[model samples]
Target: MDFVLVHGTTQSPAGWDRVAKLLTAAGHRAIAVDLLTPRDLPVEGYAQHARDQYDGERPVVVAHSGSGVLLPAIAEALDARALVWVAAYIPDFAGGRSLRDEASAVLEPDWIGVDPTADPAKASEFLFHDCDPETERPALDSLRLFNPAVLAAHPAGAAPEVPSTVIVPTRDRTLRPDWLRRAGRERLGVTPIEIDAGHCPHLSRPAELAAILTGRA
Candidate 1:
């Protein structure tokens, strides 16, 4: 299957390198979109941008971290065959809250309006703690500031009706697993598939994550 991997906030397309490579080795095409450029898009705009990255059969759209908010619209734009969320936020369709509000308690205090780049130490501690030393370095170096406009805008539209899978990193420090579980149940109405890794499982557990994404796990 073809896959479109969407990285989260303050992250670059390079973050998906490990997982994308694994998928490609297994004979699947993968596209990791560069969502940071023209860093002025809202949720819908990002969805369209991701859609434009590929032209082929409906791909399985995978979302990581903050990129989760883009999935609903992306599914529509791409007419996605399936949606895979890896430790991602499943937006509350109630339309009253923003992604920042959903992540406020878990995110660092200075996550917004202060610095666009992620602190190296914090990224090590929270996002890449479970990754290999080599994997963690590139992941950290690839971090970039996200579109602040995305944080403030509430995800519009209901969750897409495509087949969906939600994977919760059991050891996540950035977004607690308990909250991930609850969000998966409450927002997406699916029991999350748990994995033993931190926030960036694609780096720490690429083969395992790849298996799950491809339904081998």
Candidate 2:
């Protein structure tokens, strides 16, 4: 399947380096797009660009973290065959709340210090707990800073009928695992595959994560 990999907040297309390489090595075509700034533009205008620009048939829409909000629209617009979510916020039709609202409401971390904005210190401190110094170290250096103004803006929810699979990180500080699992059922009405990892399992445990994605697990 043609894979359209999307990075989460404060993350660029570069975040998918290891996973993309593995996909290529295995002969699966995987393309990672910058969720923070696609087409050198803001996230608000993503629905338009993806519709007109994407070139593929039955593309598997793989979205991570905050980027999950826009997948239903992209899939609807681009006519995607399936959506593969990796520790993403795959909410139902009435998507719980905006990322900004959700962050402000929760008490996650001091480094997270606040909502959805990029903070390398916080990332290293919170999100990458399972990852090693080598794994978290580089990601810290290249942390993608989103347009805070855009993040604070209201979030449009994903479509209800879009076919999707949610991959839950059982222990995530960035997003509650229980919350994601509930959303996967309540919103998507689908049972999710729960994994014991942090936010981005594709980085920390690529073999298992990929096996789950490729369905050899």
Candidate 3:
């Protein structure tokens, strides 16, 4: 299947390095996109590029992290066959609630060090809930700094027009499994698959994640 891999907040095209390699090796076409965000444009503006790039291909959209906000827009614009969300932010596409607000409200008050004031890169731990030290070390170290604006916008959650798959990182603290399901997956006909990993499954569990994508698991 042709694929469009959308990285989470502030993530450039390099973030999908591992995923792109795996998908291509499996004989699938993958287009890893880097939307221009953190600029003066609105989230809708970024969403437009995601739509325009897809052309006429019914590609599978794999979204991670803060890119969750764009799902509604992208899904609406493209003739999407399927979407696989990896530890992504699932928001109310209609009410337009920021993914950040939804995640903060869902996480219990006990989880501290969330650092609402800190940059997204420094707060990487919140996304990788149960990842090993090795898998997370470099990712956390190279985390690109971006403002919270990506997650602060209203995500079009009224309803998604396409079928989607939501892979919940079981240990994800950034976008909790429960919240991800409720926020959008269940509404969008997505079969929520639970994986024993942290936020970035493509980075740490490429084989398992690829299997799921290929329908072998």
Candidate 4:
């Protein structure tokens, strides 16, 4: 099966490197996208970029962190087979809360004007506290500045019409596990697949993460 991996805000395709490598080694195709930047683009624009990356194949669309809101649009555009949320923000459409609003309530206080790339120490603490030095260092070094505009944008109208799964990192400090569980249940209506790792499980536990992705776990 094909897997189109979408990284969160400010993150590059490199974030999926380890997981993608493992997926390929196991005989599945993995396509990781570097989300469009400047964050000024509408949600549709982000979805279009994701759609454009497709090679005319209906892949399982896997989104991480803030990119969850875009899954509905991208899935519609690509006719994706399934959707996977990895420690992602599941927008509450029925509750009338946009993904940005939900995320801002949790993340904006600390991240608003801070440049992730400029403050490796802070970034490391927020994103990689559970990661070992070897795993955390490179991630910190590659951190990019998050686009404020993206955080300000709202989600698309409807929920994605595809099979979906939510993967919650049990030890995640960035997006607390309890919050993710409530959000996943209320928004996506699915029981989360819990992983004993941090926010970036693809980096911290690639083999385990890959097993879940491939339906072997």
Candidate 5:
């Protein structure tokens, strides 16, 4: 199967490198897209950008972190086979809330706002705590300051009718694991698959993530 890997905020397509390589080695096509900048573009535009990255068959669209808000739109645009959320925020289509609003309501006030690109030390500690320095270095370097408007933008339309899987990084320090579990059950309507990894599982647990992506886990 083919896979479209979308990275989270403050991240780049390079974050998906290891997982993509593993999937490609297993005879699956995986394209990690750079979710375009000028972040104020309509959510549909972001979806279209991701779709244009792969010309292969319909894929399993996987979203990480902030990219989750755009997942439903992206899945619909690509006519994806499935939707996968890895340590990602699951949006409520009916709520008419922005990612920031939703996150603030459930998360501790202090956790709600922080620029990931502002502090490399803090970013590494929260996002890559389970990762080694080699993995942490590039991820930190790749952090880009996305517009705050992106978080304030709401996801458009209802979630597409498709099979969806949410993978919770059990040891995640960034997005609280307990909050993720509640969000997965309440919004996505499914129990999440748990992985013993931190926020960036693609970097921290590539082989295991690849296994889950390939349906081997």
Candidate 6:
């Protein structure tokens, strides 16, 4: 099966390198997209970018973190076989709330900053604390600042009709596991698949994450 991986904000396709390697070894084509560029575009533009890059037949679309908001449109456009949310936000379609509102409600006091990418150290602490120093260093250096307007904008269109799965990282410091479970159930109507990892499981537990994605876990 083909897997289209959409990365979170402030990150690039490189973040899925390890997980993609594992999926490829298992004979599945894994395509990781970089949604950080053209930072001026809104959430719809990111969804269009993802849809434009996919050239396979009904691939399973997996989105991480903030990119989850784009899945509804991407799935509809691609006629995706399934939608997978990895430690991701399941937007409340009924509420018409933006990603920024959800983020601000949960922002840690230390996370307060005008520019999220300005301090690499704090970014690492928030995102890659569980990653190995060697792996985390380059990721930190490559971090980019995504336009806040994307988060502030409401997700375009309603949730798609594709079957969905939510992967909740139990050890994620960025998003609480309980909140993910509750949100996943309330919004997506699916129970989450729990993993013992941090926010970036593709970096910290690639093999294990791949197993789940490949139906071997």
Model 3, 1-217: lDDT tens digits are 8878887764456667777788889998888776754474566677677776666577787888777767666765666777777777666655656645565665544443344225544446465445466756645543554434655655555666567778887776655567776754455666688888866777778778887887721
Find the 10 residues in a row with the least total lDDT in model 2: 104-113
| Model 3 lDDT at residue 195 | 86
**Lowest lDDT block of 10, candidate 1:** 107-116
Q: Which RMSD does model 1 reach against the true structure?
A: 2.4
TM-score of 2: 0.82
- Enumerate clash totals for all models, in the order shown: 0, 1, 8, 0, 0, 0
Once fitted onto the true fold, the runs of candidate 3 whose alpha carbons sit more than 4 angstroms away are: 51-56, 93-96, 107-124, 127-142, 148-150, 155-157, 184-186
Model 4 C-alpha lDDT per residue in residues 1-217, reported as the tens digit of each score: 8999988765678889889999999999999976765556777787788777778678888888777777777777778889998988787767667755666554535555555566777777667777887888667755765454654567447777777888989977677788888877877788888999877787788888899989922
Q: Return the TM-score for each candidate structure.
A: 0.90, 0.82, 0.78, 0.89, 0.91, 0.89
Candidate 5 similarity to native, TM-score: 0.91
lDDT tens digits, residues 1-217, model 5? 8899988887878889899999999999989888866556778888788777779877899999888878898888899989999987777766666777666654534445666678877787678889887887877766775544655567435756888899999888778888889878877788888999988899999999999989822
Best by lDDT: 5
Query: How much lDDT does candidate 4 score?
Result: 0.77
**lDDT of all the models against the reference?**
0.78, 0.68, 0.67, 0.77, 0.81, 0.77
Candidate 2 RMSD to the correct structure: 3.3
Clash count (model 6, backbone only): 0
What does candidate 1 score on TM?
0.90
Question: What TM value does model 4 have?
Answer: 0.89
Candidate 1: deviation at residue 123, Å? Answer: 1.2
The superposed Cα distance between candidate 1 and the true structure at residue 198, in angstroms, equals: 0.5
Superposed by TM-score, candidate 1 places the C-alpha of residue 194 at a distance from the truth, in angstroms, of: 0.5
lDDT score for candidate 5 against the true structure:
0.81
Tell me the tens digit of each residue's lDDT in model 6 across 59-110: 8888887777777777777788998899887787767777777775533444
